[model samples]
Structure formats: C-alpha cells, structure tokens
Target: MACMQLLLLLCLLVSLCNCYRMFGRFSRIPPEPQSDSAVQDQWFEQKLDHFRGADTRVWKQRFYVNDSFTHSDGPVFLMIGGEGSANPAWMTHGTWITFAEKMGALCLLLEHRFYGKSHPTKDLSVDNLRYLSSRQALADLAHFQTVMTEKLGLGKRKWIVFGGSYPGCLAAWYRLKFPHLAHAAVASSAPVQAKLNFSEYLDVVQSSLARNDSDCPNKFKVASATLIQLLNFVENYEKITSDFRLCQPLEINTKMDRAFFLDTIAEYIMDVVQYNNDNREFEGVKTTNITIQVVCGIMANESWGSPYDRYVEVIRTILKATGEKCIEASYKKYVEEMRSSCWEGPAASGGRQWMYQTCTEFGYFQSSDSSSQPFSGFPLSYHVQQCTDIYGNEFNLAMITGAIQQTVENYGGLNIESSRIVFPNGLIDPWHALGINTSLGTDIVAIPMQDAAHCADMYPARPEEPFVLPAVRKLVYELLTKWLQL
Candidate 1:
C-alpha cells in the first residue's frame, strides 16, 4: 500500500510539472503559479495510441474551456496548441477566445501530444519518438474531437480551428487532412511549404533593419565581412575571442564551429526583430520594448573604427541590451549544447520533439546566402550536416531533400487549394517569406499585416499594438462568419 501511494504521488507530481512547462515557452513576463487543482480544471485523459492497437495506456491532456458564452447549438472555437505545453492563458487571453465569446461559441484549447501532460511513452528515445509525427498528432486531435463532442452531446456544432506559428501550420494542415473534423482554419504565420534552404529569412531581417535605418544593414554587412576575414587567421581569431568575451575559444579548424558561431549571432538578431514590440518584453532577456531603430541607435553612437572593431562594439551593445552579462559569449557552448545528443541530454522533450519534426518533415534551415549578408558564415550545408548529426547518417542531404519534396507534394505547399482557411502573416516577421502571402482560391485569403511581428493578430487586443493587427483580427472574424454561413 505504501509503495502504491508513493507511485501515485510521483505521477501527480509529473502531471504538475507538465503544467509548469506551459509557462516555460513564454518567459517574457512571468505568469502566476497555479496549484495542481487549478491546473486540473477542464483537463482530459485519453489513450496514447489513438491509431495503433488497444494498448490502453492513458495520459492526461491539458486543455482550457470557456462555456460562458457558448450556446447549446453554437459554433465550436478550437485553438490547437503549439510546440510547447498548452496553457489556459490562451483560452483566457488571445483574440480567438474573445471572438468565440462574441459569437456565443464553445471555446476549447487542446494541448498537443508529447507536449504538456500528454506524453505517449515513458521515455523519449528516437525509437519511441516514431509516434510523434504531425500525422499522429492530428489523429489524436480527431479522436479527441470525436470523444469530447460525444461526451458533451455537442452534435452538428460547426468547429473552426485556430493556431499561430508552428501550430498555425498544424491548424492549416489539420483542416486539409481532416475536413470532417474542422470546418475552417485561421493560420497566422503558417509556413505551408517546408524547405531545406531558407535564405530569404535573413533577407527580411536585413529589410526590417533597413526600414529602421538604411545604414544599419550596410553596417551589419561590413561587420560580418570583417568577422569572416578574421576567422582566416589564428591571431585575429584570438583577438576576436578576447574582444567578444567568448567563454570557449572557437575551434576554427572545425567546420561546424564556424557555422555555429555565425548562426548564434544571426539567431540573436532575428529574435529582436521578430518580437519587435515596444509594449512586450523579448523572452528570457532583459531587453524590454525594443525595435530595430533602437539597435541602430546603439551602433550609430559608436565612433567609426576598423570593421573588426566596429563589429565587436556593435555586438557588445546589442548583447548588453538583450540582458547578456557580456563577460562570456561561449560560441562553443552554444553550439555543443544545441547539437548535444537529444537522446541522452538534459534538453527538454518539447525541443527534441520539434527537432525530430524538422529532421523528418520540415527542413526549414535558415542559411546565409552568397550575397553580403550578416550571417555569411552559415551555408546550406551546415544545416544539412546538423540533421545528420542529430538523427544519424540516414537523414542525409538526399533524404532531407526527398522529405522536402514529399511535404510540398503532400500538403500542396504554399499553393494549397483549400478554402475557408484565412492565412495571415506580418510584413515584419522573417517567417512571412515562407508563409502564404497571396490568395490561392476564392475562399482562401492571405492578409499581410503592415508593421507587425510574428502572430501579431493572435494576441489579445492591446492599446499599444499596431492598427493593422486588430484589423486583421476583425477580418479573421469576418472570414469565420462567412465560412460558418456555408
């Protein structure tokens, strides 16, 4: 009896840990801690293998419900959870919940499997991870929808799906794969086509910065060239290590070292630009309410110096703004940690799960181009090599290329002929280049929100938000209304 009780307590603790991870994904502003009982609200339990045999292994799936505005025969607003743990915050906040309330519709936020508390297997080994595909996830949703509706006796209620970012891709794909489950979808920043080379990402970053200050892009370009040239010499490399305050000396001999070093800098720049909101804080950083203009202003204040000197000064300024201590950059640390074996590492399951998805289906590797771009160190080959390192020799360039082609063929890519799926992306979001930016069919529409960041329309209405974001939300509502009418 004692052993059984202890086991049950351990299970309960793991369940609580799942709830905590929901806050882990978005650490910009700390959310209030909820008790286990509070976390239990509206959560459901379902079998792990919705497609496979009757193994009867059950896991709890976290979700939030709002029936206050829902009529017995009203529409169902289903917001699909993304890569991380699903939080009730989305159900309570966000435009989707508000829109559901306006339409007197049932609002439900379903967490994805292998995320939140919905773990399928006891371990996340590569072999076990075979069940963690998007196809399997969608199947889980189909089962969940069927079971939930039957349990609630919600018959013939039209269901409209909603998602943002990677979940936005899931939302659109779910509608395409399972038309019987969802009437329509609202995909914000959804990258429909999967590709191995995504050089256009940096192009947008350059453009976003140029829009802030035309000189900014040129300055960045010059700095990049200087860094690339310095990597050629041992003494210059040592100087760079000292100047940048890197915790680990970059092994220039190793090809991955060079690629990882440059990729890290590019990622930092992308984050600041991607979350370019003056009202909100960037995730896990001291940087609060920043824009590209602010970054340029910091660079502009410095005296004109050698390319190498200018590069060091600009990086230091940017790092300080983003809450880094500047005592250590740790290029090797960043690369080794990221490229560490996901099978037996301290990295979270959510990250590993996403990496697996990228390895198998979406090879959206953002590499530097032949042009004078800031991240000139990274080539398309680096990303291809990363896939091989992560998943093994089987996932080579040929395999990845085949997967990308298969994805485009299977899902219709950006040219999908699906209807009633309103695709919206921000002009400022780098991911917009991969997303649908034009209408494919009469019912399908793509609205580009001006002066907006990633998934800008998905957030709750804020006073400081750009005018175009709220307008996009209104358009989404209008689209939803039209879809339901049919």
Candidate 2:
C-alpha cells in the first residue's frame, strides 16, 4: 500500500506522513519529473480485463521511455511502477537507468493501471476494484511488452525488468509467469510471499533497531508499557490526547479506535526504521533523512525527559518534518477518508486501491499481535476491521486469509523457480523476510545485503551508502551481464 507524487503527497494524504509500505519503497516526497530530451511520455490502450473476452473496456495506461544511451540492438530495461504513479524521472534516473546506460539498453517506466494518471476505473468503488489485482497488472505488463516489441522494432531484443517493493514482486513474478517475454529480473527488497498477518514486519523492525547498536528497543518497550498502562484507564484519555497534541479527541469508544491510535503512533518509528538511510533526492528545498540512528539518538537523549516524553517528542518531530498540522489518530477519520469512492482528493494517493489489494489479494496487514513487539495494543483483528470498514462486511478475517492464501499459491511464494532473476534483499528491510534468500545454481539467485533497507540498491550508487551495497550491486551486475550477455 505504501509505494507515490511518488510518496510525499501520497503520504500527506494517506497517513499525513510516509505513505505506508510502497510510498517509502519509492520516496517520502514525490520529486517533480525533470524535463529530459531523451525521456518521452506515452500512453497505451490497456485492457481492463485480461481474462474476460466479452469485457471490451479499455483504458489509457501511462508510461515513459528514455533512449539516451540505447543502441539499436540494445537490450530493453523496463522499470515497473508499483502502487505509486510511475515517475517519468525513473526513465532518466535510478539504478535501472544506470544499468541501461551501461548496457546500452533502452529504459521504460510503466505506471500501474490504478495509480498515477492511469485510470482503469472512473472511481474507487468495490465493484470497480474487482479488476485490480497482481494477475491483471502482470497481464498489463505482457500487453505493454507486446506493444513495445512491434512499436520500437524490438522483435528479437532481450528484455530485463527492474522493480522495488511491490513492483519488485511483479518483476520476479513476471519472469516466472512469462519466461518467454522476459530475459531476467532484479527484485529489490521485495516481499514475494503473501501473508495475512505480517507480524514478522514488526519483528524485523525490532531486529533492525536493536541491531543498529541503538537502545531504541528498550526505550520503546518502557515507553510503550507506560503508555499502554495509561491508555487502559478511560480517565487518562483526555490528558493523553492533550499531551500528544492530537488534532481531535482520542477515540476509544471501540477497540478499533484504540488499535488505530497505537497503529498511528507506531508508524512514527516503523517508517523511519523501514526507510533508514538511503540516497534519495528531489528538487525540494530540503528533506530530512530520518534514519534509525536519528530515532535512537532521540530515544537515548535524557534531556528529552522520560521515555514517554521522548516518545512524544518523536511524534512532534515527525509531524514537523512532514508539515502536518497535528497528530491525526482518529480511526473514524481514517476510515472516512478511505471509504470515499472518488478518484481525486486524498484517496487518489492509491491508498484505497492498495488497501483493496491488501484486502483481496496480498494481506500485508502489519499487525502488533506479538508481545515481542513494543507496539502491542494493535492486534490482527484491527487490520481485518480496517479492511471491512473501507470495503465491506464481506472482507472478514476468513476472506482475508483466503485472499492471502490464494496469492501465495498463485505465485508459489518464496519457492518460485525462475531463472535469470536476482533477489537483492536488505537485511534491515522488514519486507526482505518474505523475499527469497538463496541461490538456485547460477541463474535464479538471492543476494543478501547487510545495512541495505527497502530498495536501497535500486537507487543510483552513492559514495556514502553502506559499503556492502557497492559489492552487492557489482555482484548483481556480474550475474545480470552473464545472463543478458550484453
């Protein structure tokens, strides 16, 4: 659900911060598309339903291409966009573009159907969203590939795919499902295995923070314990709300609201740790790289007062950074925003669409079910309820489990047997838990990278980045070159 302007506007609209998973996967602030002569924006007439022969509905899917460094017979490098709108800059920049330049490959960035300006549906109604799934998206890629083959005179040209996060899953799955259509794939920080309750996400977060030589885990445990103890008392709600500087009175009438409150609070550290430090830039005045070290530093500062006081500061710090007016912890408001069937406004962040995907296809519900996690108030039940509230009563726990199971079965989960595919996973990224971690001979392989978080390798190589990235990225290039024969 988190893949955004790529993410800033989406985050501001969806969670008033980093847009959950995918947005962070792409960016926190959406960078404007820099005008480049080599980059050309284009649209393709994509099928609304790939399976239904009778369904003749079609929509214009947006995509971009960059031919700056491409030779006539160079390989094709397609960078698939996930939940976020495909940034045209992706055609001109990013690690994929770097590879394209090196390999004399043409770069293409394809926007997902429901995201960005690609309107497969006029609205976000449940009935209309039936067509939104990974299967259909993969089909979209196939259709695009066929079109590109004819349009660009790429009849015998080999195609290699690049994707991060949800798009990463697509890249790997695309190679698996359409082996004839693709030559290879590079999936970065991708969670291929479908899960109903992603408690490991939290576990990974805890491990990420603790492994960073930061006292954040201990500080969070004390802070969360104190807050949880206080929140249990109905009388302390008012003081807690006022102290936290919430936009509205804390909602505790139902258990869902309570869970939402914890979810909102936990997201502060969750997003920070998830993103960590990655070399992402936009034409903004500035952007704060909120890493785990920054958060751990905050938690360890005794000058901030008690652990609870430090926790409050963390929220304030994040709010100020993201330019949000106040802490929005109201569960009803979140539901109200998500329930809107309109295509514009806040829901346009692809939040509703991604939320629907979570409900129907990939159940990436980051739940606080494990007591091992500091953020423990929010349970898996809240995730189910959130889905039900946005969609309908039909999206219950049973339905969610079935949907997740179906996705896992469809893709063969982590056991996907595909050749010429590279899984570059960052140990720090929680999503890496679901991605493959071993090599299958010389073709299908996983490159486990330490200190890399989210899609760190997808970004252009930076001198200041973790030392392991350069080596891992080189290994990926060696594998890719061996396979692509470029």
Candidate 3:
C-alpha cells in the first residue's frame, strides 16, 4: 500500500496534468502529508496573466534554491514543482539533489501557480482558475529560469529540467515548447495524454497486481463481483454501508452514490498498487515490500470468511494502511461541497484548482467501463456529473470533450513527438499507459523500469532501491551529458 500512498502523492503532483483528480475519489481530502521543511522559503514576484494583455497584477510565487553543489561553469538542474505545495524536503532528499551534486549543478525548485503558496489570485474561483494552466505555468518556468540565471550571475549555463509525475510532463513539454530553454529533460512517470474515461489506468492496476500473484486478479474479480451483487440489492445497501462505517447510509436513488462507494475500494487498491514502495514508510504509514501480493493473499483466503466478508476486511485493511479509518461516504455530500465550496478569500485550494483543470483541459477521469475493471460501478457518466456539479453550466460532456480533443491535437496527445527528453515510466504505474512508452524519435527515449513503482527513479536513492532505477538514472545523466556536449 506504500505504492498507493506514492500514487496519492503522485496524484497531488501529477493529477494537475492528467492521470487522476487528487480528491475526486471518496473523501480522501487533505493533501498527502509532506516531509519536514528543509530548504529556505523564498518567493518571486510573478505576473498574474502571462498571455492576456494588460493584466499588471503580480503575485508571490513560491520557490526554493540550492547552490551548494554548483560551479560557475557547471550545469543548472531545475526541479519542476507540480500541483501541490512545494516541499523543500525534495531539495535535500530527492534524487535531483544527488544528480545535481554529481554534476556540480545548482538546483532550483519552483512551485506551479495556484498550488501551494504560489497563488495568482485571492481564491480559486473560475475567473482565477482561467489563469491556472500548463501554458501559463510553462511560461512561468521559462520566465523564472531566466530571472534566476541573471540573479545568480550564471551566464549561458546549460539548464537541465527535471521532474517526476506531472512536473515530469511539464519538463518534457518545456523542451518541446521552449526548446532553447532546456538543454535536456528528464520526465519520470510523465502522463502526457489528456484522456477522458481513462479506463486504461485501471488496466495497469490489474496487471500490476496479477504480475505479483496470478491468482490475485481473479481474487480481486471475485471480490468486485461480490460487492457489485451486494450493492445491486437495495436491502443490502444499508448493511454494507454500516460495514464500511460510512458516515451515512448509502443512497439508492442514484448510480453515482453506489459508484462512489465502489470507488472508495477502487481508489484504495489503485493507490496501494501504484505506490507499492517497499523500503520506507509513506505519509506516516507502514509500507510492505510486496503490499499488493500480501493484500491479495489475504483477500483470497476463503478460510477466513465469506468472499463478501473478506472483501469488507480488505477495505478496512486498506483504510488502516493509509492511517485513516471510516470516512464520510456520502456522494451527495461531496457534490454539495463541490458546488458550494468557496474558492475565494484566503487558504490554498489545491483540490479545487486541479478539479478546474480537469473540467477545462484534461478530463482524465479514472472510471471503469468493463466488467473486468474493479470499479465497474463508476462509469463515465459519474465523472460527467461530478464536473457538471463543480462548474455548473460552464462544464459539460461537450465542453470537456472539446477540451480533450484540443489538448491532444495541440500537444501531440498520447503521441508526444518531442526530442531531447528522456521519458521513464514504471511498468507498474497505471499512469504509464497514458505516457509515451516508446521512442518516436532519435533523441526521444522511453525507458520502462520492469518492477519499479510510480516515479521510483525520481525519489532519493535507498539501500533497498530497485536495480533498474540506478541504471535509468545513469542513462538520464548520460543523455544530459551528451546534450550538453552538443
């Protein structure tokens, strides 16, 4: 389940691009717990609107810089921040620090606009969210890089952009959109495609679990069948809701409520499978070496109890694994909050900001369309309804569909043809299916880490690190070095 925690973390960072919405599933509110602050806090005055004319409003953009490993003539490693608060711990403990030190490079971590302390407006209203986009954020990176270079007196130093998950997508696109700005780019687990009804995501989850234990997928299928049967009967709904300790009884009026219930289970499984990191605790929860295998074994054991009972136990187990217990399970409550939540005034609204992105640009909703898919109850309609509730008349299937098509056409969609970028994805990462998994050009490379989890290569190295990660990092360094030489 450690991998799930990593997935949750990745969602906070990567979901801003596509992949999945961080708080869209269940009541998994509150951003993943961050590590201790290690880097100095600093802010840059940035323009409110990068493209639109005559918007002179300036906002404080949060960033952190580390020049300890830099040399006057060495390269600069820019760690692109994603959809969450910019944690300085990355500066001290992330793999970029190690790579930067190895290359004697300066490291700078810049938070994306509307995320963390980098707010361009007072709130996350629709008007404010109009300015929150990849285009503007990419512009922010370019402008910030130029300013930092001048401020630090680094003249024409080679700049290497580095990021994992969503920022990773940005890193690769920066090279494509602003080719001259980045010498090379390392985009680890970057999901470049903006998809609607991203059922392929669940496919990766199923495949990863089955790879660990072949019987695991069958066991999961049985559990899902049991839940589907149980939930289909209105009489069983109240009992099942109580079993899951839902704050309220499950509603039978709409398919959305049932799908929400099933998604809690689906989200838990997806979270653990993608983030299955063995060596360390994640977000203060204990993570096993083979979490999916262990959970599958437990769920498959018939001697313990009935399949439905065992499934219930598995749900409880997953909740406990994340250091959380029974939560409010009302889909209606979620919709009500989504509609009434204030994105204005003070406080950082990460979830609201990202939801707007999903509504506008990338409808990467993780819904299931097949019986083989675990969360089969969550059809694409559930996602559309959620979007409608959030954005009112401004959001709909037609509008979201248009945005998806435009995003794909403009950025190469699933077929990103950018060069001078190294795209590394873990086979187990569900988001890998949405990214560029094969090289389409001479300078564009895609390396799949066989047993690695989401963005495993981007984290700080550990004694228990997978063998392929170091190999991939070495390749990334070689690529960057080769690019610099040219």
Which candidate number has the best TM-score? 2
Local accuracy of candidate 1 as per-residue lDDT tens digits, 1-486? 543454444343232222222121111222222334323446677677767676777777777777878997679988887676566656556788788778889988888877655666665656777777777777777878999999999999999999887888888988998898899999988888888788888888888888867888777777777788888888877777777766456567688877777766556566667767633321222554556777666556556475556657656766666545433233334333334333323233355566667778888777886473555888889878876776678979898888778888888888886778989988988889889998887778899989988888887677888888777888889989888888
Q: How many residue pairs clash in all the candidates, one count each?
A: 1, 6, 6
Runs with alpha carbons beyond 4 Å of true place in candidate 1? 1-43, 47-58, 236-239, 278-288, 304-345, 370-372
Which residue pairs does candidate 1 place in steric collision? 247-330
What residue pairs clash in candidate 3, if any at all?
2-275, 3-275, 3-276, 4-271, 4-272, 124-343
lDDT of 3: 0.74
Runs off by more than 4 Å, candidate 3: 1-38, 278-290, 340-349
64-161 per-residue lDDT for model 3 (tens digits): 88888989878999888777777676777666778788889988889899877787876556666789888898999998988877888989999989
Instruction: Tell me each candidate's TM-score.
Output: 0.85, 0.92, 0.90
Please identify model 2 stretches exceeding 4 Å from their true place. 1-40, 283-288
The ten-residue window of minimal lDDT in model 3 covers 13-22
Model 2, residue 178: C-alpha shift (Å):
0.5
lDDT of each: 0.71, 0.79, 0.74
Best by lDDT: 2
